[model samples]
Target: MKRNKRKSDEMFNLDDIKVYMQMSAKDKLYWLERVAKFLHKITPSKNKKIWERLKERGF
Candidate 1:
């Protein structure tokens, strides 16, 4: 048996959006916060000005 893995750049389909839309408000907020934190952790802090701006914006 063989498996076909998805490419990293593949876009989410309507079904995926529909599933997300069906989630409760609380669940949606949880996921949003999780993604934000993950992005913050991965972002490089090469520019002090940008980091200060993000902090000022409450990111």
Candidate 2:
């Protein structure tokens, strides 16, 4: 059975891509950090090197 996806999962359509492309540098940085943090959280404990890299980048 497929799980229901969140709105974030559906945010990569053309309109959203346009909006992302039009975002200011600061806005882009903000979103980038958010994505990095999210990835860091879900990363496996076995990947300590990956986690450290994210931390070094201030994620």
Estimate, for each residue in 1-59, the C-alpha lDDT of model 1 and write its tens digit. 12345468866555567778989999899989998898888888776579899999999
The model with the greatest lDDT is: 2
State residue 1's C-alpha deviation in candidate 2, in Å. Answer: 28
My TM-score estimates for the predictions, one after another, are: 0.59, 0.57
Query: How big is the RMSD of model 2?
Result: 8.2
What is the per-residue lDDT of model 2 for residues 6-47, given as tens digits with 9 covering 90 to 100? 477675466666678889999989989998999889888879
**Candidate 2: where are CA atoms >4 Å away?**
1-12, 48-59
Local distance difference test, each candidate: 0.77, 0.77
The 10-residue segment of model 1 with minimum total lDDT is 1-10
Provide the global lDDT of candidate 1 against the true structure.
Answer: 0.77
Q: Give the TM-score of candidate 2.
A: 0.57
